[model samples]
Target: MTFNAEPFTYRIAKSGDVHISREGRLVVMVRGNAAAKLAAALGNGDESDQQLLARATGNYKRGNERLAGSKRR
Candidate 1:
């Protein structure tokens, strides 16, 4: 996927320290937790919180419908 370089930013933080970067996607690690891991658990990459939530919700709903339909067959 192609993203606009000027329009996107990445925020990396650990504890109280934070780093802001214009790079699209990345991994920020502090101790054992990384931003990339957090994003994966939430679904996809460094998308905005709202965007990730919407995508995850849509994926869940679609998966549920698919499973339900399969079970009915």
Candidate 2:
């Protein structure tokens, strides 16, 4: 028999919190340390499958000094 996996979806609320849901029901709204962890992971991980996650929670540091716009002094 073939198997199918359930799907999970998530979004970031206007209050800067992350909400995770399965089957259209909210399972959890991650905040505090949990939200922080998710944000950190998004910054470091490949997120082709998690476009919403990045849009909602990723806070990445700029990698290049020249492009970041600051004097080297």
Q: Which candidate is the best by lDDT?
A: 2
> For each candidate, what is the lDDT?
0.38, 0.55
Inter-residue clash pairs, candidate 1: none
lDDT score, candidate 1, position 5: 34
Tens-digit per-residue lDDT, 1-73, candidate 2: 1114424467666666778676788766778777766655543323442544433433422346566677656
Model 1 per-residue lDDT tens digits across residues 1-69: 223333333344445322322244422322234435534454244446434333323332344555765
lDDT of 1 at 52: 38
True-vs-predicted CA distance for residue 17, candidate 1, Å:
9.6
Q: In candidate 2, which residue pairs clash?
A: none
- Which parts of model 2 are misplaced by more than 4 Å? 1-6, 43-73
lDDT of 2 at 11: 67
Question: What global local distance difference test value does model 1 have?
Answer: 0.38
